[model samples]
Target: MRYLPVLASVAALLATSGVAVASPAKIPVRVVLVTTFELGKDSGDIPGEFQNWVEKLPLSEELPAPGSYHEVLRYNPDLHVIGIVTGEGPAHMASAMTGLVLDPRFDLRKAYFILAGIGGIDPEFGSVGSAVWAPRVINGGLAHLIDPREIPSGWSDGFVPVQGDRPDLEPVPPLHSQWGDMGYTLNPGLVNWAYELTRSVELPDASSLQANRVRYKGFPKAQTPPAVMVGDTLSSETFWVGARMNRWAERWVKYWTENTGTFATTAEEDIAFMQALSAQAKAGRVDINRVLILRTASNYDMPPPTETAASLLKEEANETGFSGFVPSLDSAWRVGSVVVKELALHWEKYENETPENK
Candidate 1:
């Protein structure tokens, strides 16, 4: 009976230590909605990027996320959809994405990732409250920058390509090797399909949005109502503003994409998000091609003719100061939910084949 007691004690220890218990079967996630931040709680408060998904989608279950920026994840059991808030900025986004792909509690191999957020829109390409789908995400921080006062007489601005000595260097050096992470080209077919599917999506148009857009006197596109369009994004931690910075953003995207990408949205996290997902893809944890980026225009990247960049930025420091703040959030959910619903409802088809391939 001494052996029996010892065996019982061992069993107890093993059970307490989780060594004798098998982990629960991993949950199969069909769709992941990634938002950058939340204004308050997940619901019943002023909404940020995450509120609509949590409330409208009705993510009722909470899942523990150990290493993510936001330690809690919201889930909708019926839809097989998961919502994550990555806080904000590049560091938070990278860490949250890495944590998500590495979490063993979920099977994400066939999951579709939708990164939906708001960004500063390029007035030349879009107006506030516009929803943009981007196939190209360029890292705007990977560059050599000098103060404008110290820049060479002929240079446009101080920013230069990481692989070149000057702005718009001829025959841009091949960045596919060491600097490959600096630019990410998403599945073009998928982007185009998403654009076509949601191109006619009518975004919320309010008097505030209209009044704000009219300030861009020379930018015809900015004066028009919001629309769904396909544009490229530039990601950087620096919240740059002004005409010069806008020009640099446009040229930078073109330079990185070999004159193929038009910069429309300026944001802070997509590059890091893509990098993390790319790593997960290599490990076969996620399908990188199933990723989609949607950015709504909460504000303009630069000031209008009536205001200076400094003044505009100061005004925008308050979250509600952006004229399209509420409208942009509405646009994000409106445009993004269409795809989310389709994918969730038709998981059998999307699980085997991405929309682009279909």
Candidate 2:
């Protein structure tokens, strides 16, 4: 007697029995977690923040947004949540966000967006590992660059807003008025509400962060452990590190928000990511008011006066300066998780109505 091959027989039996494999269900994500990049298995490989969230959360679906830099999204159906990484930098973030929002697989209409990432914090505002809620985001990249020596002696930075032919003698109005340049804001109620929710969360700490804070010896805020606060953020393509650069950031945020926005964190992608979100909101695909930008202080934009910017940037021992990424990431997770938990746990109340920011 001749025996049929086991694989073929099994396939035929299964087919005859009408047993078919079922595809995973599509995710209707209610909360979207955004991250810029994550630790690579190798020192420089780069995994993604989505991995950590997926590991912690009960994400079952791995949905693919074909053209996005963070092509895959890990999702949890029961909680209605999804997490994605937009790679790193402005262009990649803009692309990933735009693509994800427009994709047909998921409906993001009622979803709340959370931009959680590491950034350069102004020491005057907070210490490393501090988590901040940005009420406004100003652009620092749309500027004309000049050599510091060539710029007027009174100006702190060589960078000037594009509308002007020269650096301003004093920080003034129309911070970003030249055509495409502009600043962005989050809903005041939403921002304040988020701050109230996360302010009490005990953030992570580190000995290195303590040593780093000592550099800010005189500045009380910078010398303490990380805390959650509300402040504004500035986005720029340049990874600036110096006294002059810090001054530029502080002034730029002040000018753009008409003295309302306080510059707290410095990063490259928040503005780019938000621009896309705002556009989608105009098309009615997203709820702009529900969006939140949360930045954790991974490092300071400049070193203490005792150390020169050049030395901090070039010193072999310093590598990337006094702060570590883990502390900030931990702080961000600890605080951000609370807000997410509130939304998921009380979806009925928050689903159709906006939370009172006050």
Candidate 3:
């Protein structure tokens, strides 16, 4: 989708003006593309790719939000796509979402949301640039927090289950859920349909990414080039790393999903993001089942076998360590674009009707 040059320039103008354009932030739009924080305020970094991509699309409206983290938008009046940047992390996600969803300018009840972001991936399950469709989004932040050293000798990790008194129990609903619903399980049909649509799309790869993937010695899947897959996501405000935390992530997803969902990516905001969506659903603003999350692995959650977590910390902070950042953004947008495009092209079929998983 080619973007209008004016739309690209409008972002700069909005940043300088620190004001909302007179355009409507409220409208019955087709799609609400939700992206998390971009590194630079004015725009730079892989996280900003989604907005950059939107800039290239034909824009009909520029609804700027100087008071908010970012802006609401309009692309292809015909396609009716609007993008929302949920700031970053869980708190930012809730705040930004509340502002956007509750804003009176746009109607969200019929909008299809795609929460796309980069995540720390498990090399055991996927590689950098691999796009994952989350069937279940589990919260890793709101849990029993214990210092690993003080926990029972046999305890798996520092994070204990919120539902049970012990660390190793599956989550039982109506127990400790802050969100009335224990976990946000996306519509199976929507998730499967999304997976099927982009699973075959060829994602870009880089030599640095290849070298990084090669580090996953024993895991063949992580060694492959970027691809799309269906997997679950783990959301924690704590950006954790190490074999221990990685194991906790896997076990947490397993316990929450009852082995039905496999954890592939680790992110910081999906749980809170979805919870807000649930609220909007209750208010008859949006369909909870229409929400979809796509996470691309920007880097592995744990250090490779050859490197110790402590040893790799400094390196992981370097640009070379996150070689997948750019490619992952590419993969996410490329794969996610398919769904966004297909729906926009066939809005008559998808606007009011939820498509089957087929």
Deviating ranges (above 4 Å) for candidate 3 = 1-26, 41-47, 58-60, 71-74, 170-173, 177-182, 318-321
- Looking at model 3, residue 274 earns an lDDT score of 90
TM-score quality measure for candidate 1: 0.93
**Top candidate when judged by lDDT against the true structure:** 1
The sequence of per-residue lDDT tens digits that candidate 1 reaches over residues 281-326 is 9989899999999999999999998789899989898666788999
Which residue pairs collide in model 2, if any? 40-46, 189-357
Q: Lowest summed lDDT over 10 consecutive residues: which window, candidate 1? A: 1-10
- Residue 72, candidate 3: C-alpha displacement in angstroms: 5.2
Q: RMSD for each model, in Å, please? A: 5.5, 6.6, 5.6
Give residue 350's lDDT in candidate 1 (0 to 100): 88
- The digit string of per-residue lDDT tens for model 3 on 1-358 reads 2344455467569867897665533445778778886555423443464555565544445666656767544456667887777777898888887788877767888889898888878888988888899988888877778887788877877676665667766445456543343477888899999998888999888887888888878888888888898888988888778888888888878877776768899988998889888887898988987889999888888888898987656777753357688888778788888888788778888877888832
Q: Order the numbered candidates by lDDT, best leading.
A: 1, 3, 2
Q: Give TM-scores for every candidate, taking all chains together and pairing residue i with residue i.
A: 0.93, 0.85, 0.87
In candidate 1, clashing pairs total 0
Task: Give the Cα lDDT of each candidate.
Answer: 0.88, 0.77, 0.77
* lDDT (Cα) of model 1: 0.88
Q: State the displacement of the C-alpha of residue 137, model 2, in Å, after optimal TM-score superposition.
A: 0.4
lDDT of 2: 0.77
